[model samples]
Target: MKLKTLVGTFALAALPASMSFAWADAAPEMTDAERAQAKQIYFERCAGCHGVLRKGATGKNLEPHWTKTLQDGNKVEGGTLKLGTNRLERIIAYGTDGGMVNYDDILSEKEINLMARYIQQTPDAPPEFSLKDMRDSWKLIVPKDKRPTRQMNKINLQNVFAVTLRDAGKLALIDGDTHKIWKVLDTGYAVHISRLSASGRYVYTVGRDGLTTIIDMWFEEPTTVASVRLGSDARSVDVSKFKGYEDKYLIGGTYWPPQYSIMDGETLEPIKIVSTRGQTVDGEYHPEPRVASIVASMTKPEWVVNVKETGQILLVDYTDLKNLKTTTIESAKFLHDGGWDGSKRYFMVAANASNKVAAVDTKTGKLAALVDTAKIPHPGRGANFIHPQYGPVWATGHLGDAVVSLISTPSEEAKYAKYKGNNWKVVQELKMPGAGNLFVKTHPKSTHFWADAPMNPEREVAESVYVFDMGDLDKAPVQLNVAKDSGLPETTAVRRAVQPEYNLAGDEVWISLWGGKTDQSAIVIYDDKTLKLKKVITDPAVVTPTGKFNVFNTMHDVY
Candidate 1:
């Protein structure tokens, strides 16, 4: 693709010195139509990894230049590194080996060319989202008093699975027992995660577009009762789950504006807004330090908020919003999603770029340990189970390496005392054929550990999943070709398998077969003990199935 030459020498020069002030005033190199289209494309695809402010996290920072202010009011400029339009276009079109998806087919040649030039100009900054903004955006679809007082459907609520239908901006709640689509409701675009409330009655979904929806399952058919917009882009959300505070409040973390907000869990009313902009653990001010992930504490009435750029884990006390108290625990930067350990006391999260796993002792409100691991650990809520040698261990898969690192975790039980010496260390690294893994999962009752390599560039490896025997860690993982098993015609796009979820009984495991929007997508179910294909759910509504959240498993914090 031919492009206009951008005059810059620095690496990925995405902006000029005065972009913050002149973005609206200056006429850009691209037309208004090109600029608006590129902005939408970046928010939906690039912002989650590169960040809304162009600060890098799971991906590289796309900022054009760096500036520093001296103590005496003098400004210093850093060395410039500009990725010219030619290089930028190729990288965006062909993608990188670092798990970035190539957009050659997804975007037209003209659109791809437009993006290359768009990044070369000053990136447009979004307007600040305030408390009044959230209040104005809030919508109470169904009144609380008008809702069902009891279970109105015969479907087992505990075994229902909230399936994210990507690209369609909808969610399909499937019955795990009958393997049928119970209901399909319109939702936010590219719903990132489906979080079940403490009571398993309300399903909360936070999308890439920052739209949060609460689905009430007690109705005859599952219905979206409330919804709200957090910002232009967001990822994680969790309901308060403590003993006395179950489903009272919800917390959401956003990629843009670098902040988190609290809302009423039942009505989706906005409560407060707190910005996460701060200095990194390295003691340098970062403009776009975002809240990467959030999970509610089982024991304490607090939320563990992971700040990506700042490398800070904030223990936010939700009990007092007016005088909010937060205990910040410093760890490694590039923090992403994670879950509780076997005992639910230590929360283990991946600091992806740091090549480390940070365990926070929620009981003590302190940083427990940071264990070094293989490259780019991408553990989506991680897996926790008993290892024959390590006793209780949490498992994480890597995107940059073909290994699943199992780290020993502490347990208070006398039966696990012998394995205490191996605590907070990588006990084993199970081998796989390739990397680019996104999620690894296991259940308390199941004897198998499931991991997916959805991000791998190779079609064969990307469309396959591996199951490790918990009883014998030395045995090779059982690789299942999910795409072949689906019996769907092969397309040019690789149908990647991702996000393995288990039923309430842990007897069945479900995997989402993620493909292109036009390509047919499916959810493949397998028997846990036999490792045999049990069911393949393919329908017009199942377009680009990505994440599946089992109600019982998610509500109870089962890995």
Candidate 2:
């Protein structure tokens, strides 16, 4: 049977008599086909924030059971009073004020009703994916020997943008120089991140559906050279970046089955799989400690694998995958995406639920520090810059709070010797207009820091971006409404401006104006210095564009 068919097949049989409340009778019973369709919709749309099991992280838990602890500290449980079928349907169709996007524009009325019922039923326990299964799913479309040995096109390879065409399961390679779509190739469903190989030749993308694809940039028109299924669901993927291990091994982290897979970097052949299910930082067993993000260390021949719920950061030595040596360091929980500091020695990541940012020293393979920050820090490879007062610092925006946090970082430069005391501390918090900020970014060559609030509840703030001047810290950021700047006709659905990325030269900043599949989406480029609209690249081919990764910038780990 297909995965979707298997998804909720056990729901009816496994549900207890008490769970089948009279309220559930109001919600229509779903046929096998309806169940499959609803399951797929949830996987593509809701699984990222809310887990496959529907036990939430960033979003609220959608489990069939609800346990409420009253002020007296007594467990009040009879049935799911908080989430009846009627209430679930309303929430699914209209969404909530807490950063959840409404499905009115994205899904049809019937589809929304289907999802409402699907979540109220028992969530299926997806089958575990073994290394053998991954090997069976691996496909080498173009062998390494068959790929080109040299650049075959005149296009500026460094400026190429691997734009994630979300909802369409494809990636568009756009020329930053000419603002043209060079080629569009198939990728996984809702590709989360596009990681570049150290040599800047291979582009690796891992989607929410756990499909990892490797595209060869050396091809005449960038082609999908290799592909593999990491698991039922995946988020992060990266190639080994150390000097001797450039593109030697690839690591993909999955959300379901709670594991990560290692493969040959060139061919994407599965080598080993490691389960992340273990005790959380609090020493309690967590069955679904999903592997959130994986980063290749520059100082050591290891990969920094962060297990989300467990708050355990594993430094897996790539030199010996056979008898794999892993050093696990305990830190704060809800660990999410992160990047290297200015020195590239300290890897800083957000322990968002803990409201802290955990810094790991790769050199020592130990927990350096866990600095407290604003609520729900969602830093997307956070911005690194030299502070006028605090010396070198890292920046992160929040999802639950309205502020961009600046944490001082240690640096070796003699010029920054005076601010050594400020290292690993939250130096400042720039107030934002609203909450629900997902990504913050900056460039070494650029004079500004860029942040996006696409997750903001309000349409005005959600459709705009803020730019901060590095020279003047006291001044407020200039908010640019990118949705209006795109020059596209207004649509009823909110067009979110997200993932501000810089060109290879850092002269241009591209913002993806993500909209519904039917809406006209655009890639808005702005002059980094002038902060003026340069070009709005809108093509019918660029549908539901979200994350844009520049080839050179991503390869070098440029913020």
Candidate 3:
């Protein structure tokens, strides 16, 4: 039976008539008077859809979504509610659009803040499906259309790598085992950051544009979809692995290097905003503005987070999706991008400011380890975040001198290292044959096909794809220049950040490349085992207005 059908079948039998809600994390402490006022405010305005209990009458239960992720790559479910500062601000400024309304003009920001505080202090649960029960329902159904038809290979030293890409405003997916290209499924929103569930059953993504979408791996159609308006633009998003709280979610802020916006995952309700004071030095003054205005200034940058100003990270409980916290770290600098390891034990981000990768222990809420990537490159304004496989991390530096660093766990460390130890050294730094530092990739399935130049477009630097020799880092990563006979001529130019991903079967690597002159985008499939070019699929739908071309910035995630 198909996965979706199986899930539907089980859902029909396993799901109880009603579920009891529970908060997973403790709420941030507040005063009694303030708490009372907050409760009154919540019922006055928010109770229409969200129950007076802040649970939910017409919407989702906020209590069950509060759980978060753990270091073991598992989820910690059930805790008390905490109304983090950011969570309060967002909820007041932007009311939800679909089931909720904009509150910027209706309620004073102060009222919203107090109400959020009260809600956080007060814990409540509504009826819903338990994780175990939900999983059972999914198990008896047919999987989504994107699941692989062929048998998957046993992941080994040669086969693990994460494929990075963008989806249609949705979460991207990478095969959990091989890190190869899995199908890129739409999460229901323009994806800024994509995250997977602890069990790899769901993929989550949100955008600065105030859109959030979640995709169910077991369902053929969308499992659950919701969005919230932050009023101020958003910066980044992180999904917790905590059990019971898998439904919980949170987003970051931005505006002059904006702060993060925290929200409710299950109901798509805005909660609060985390802000960083802008510098007033040099007699220059800066005031925070709406996110939409700030985003209009950039020419082509995708997302921006000023870790220098705000050393804050957002956390949420997956169970109730009600509790949230934004912690600030002092004396920290140059934080780079991050991703969760396979075990879900931890999620590490590049602290480019400190010249080291800071690994945050999800369970203890501590800075567990800092692996130095000293020789690689200096931290800069832009850094790309990629999760090759669940555990191993991949990052590309803009200031780093032509190199890609790969950090692996105990099991895959040796294969990631060029020489002896795979501790904190540059595993591989392939000099960019091009000018910009931007880089993206798809999964590595077969070694059959390679990147090469086209004969038609233009003869610049032999415009082609460079294949790297994973075994050697110091020597130049091998570049495979496709011959004129290989599909499009060797001279055709492709865009930047075009990563190829391997399918679940580990046979094909799918790549979306931009055609320089044709102003068109082409999806190239490389035969992994043979390292040869296979087929090029062109899309006329993606056309740029000015350049008469359509281009894909990053490889969207595989579902």
* Worst ten in a row by lDDT for model 1: 1-10
What lDDT, from 0 to 1, does candidate 2 have?
0.85
Of 1 and 3, the candidate ranking higher by lDDT: 1
lDDT of 2 by residue, 343-440 (tens): 99999999877789999999888999999998789998998999888889999999878899999998888999899899899999988887778999
Output the worst ten-in-a-row residue range by lDDT, candidate 2: 1-10
Q: What is the lDDT of residue 171 in candidate 2?
A: 95
Tens-digit lDDT track of model 3 for 262-319:
4454444555544454432222323331121111001111122324323333333323
Return the top candidate by lDDT: 1
Task: State the C-alpha lDDT per candidate.
Answer: 0.86, 0.85, 0.37
Worst lDDT window (10 residues) for model 3?
544-553
lDDT of 2 at 428: 92
Better of 1 and 2 by lDDT: 1
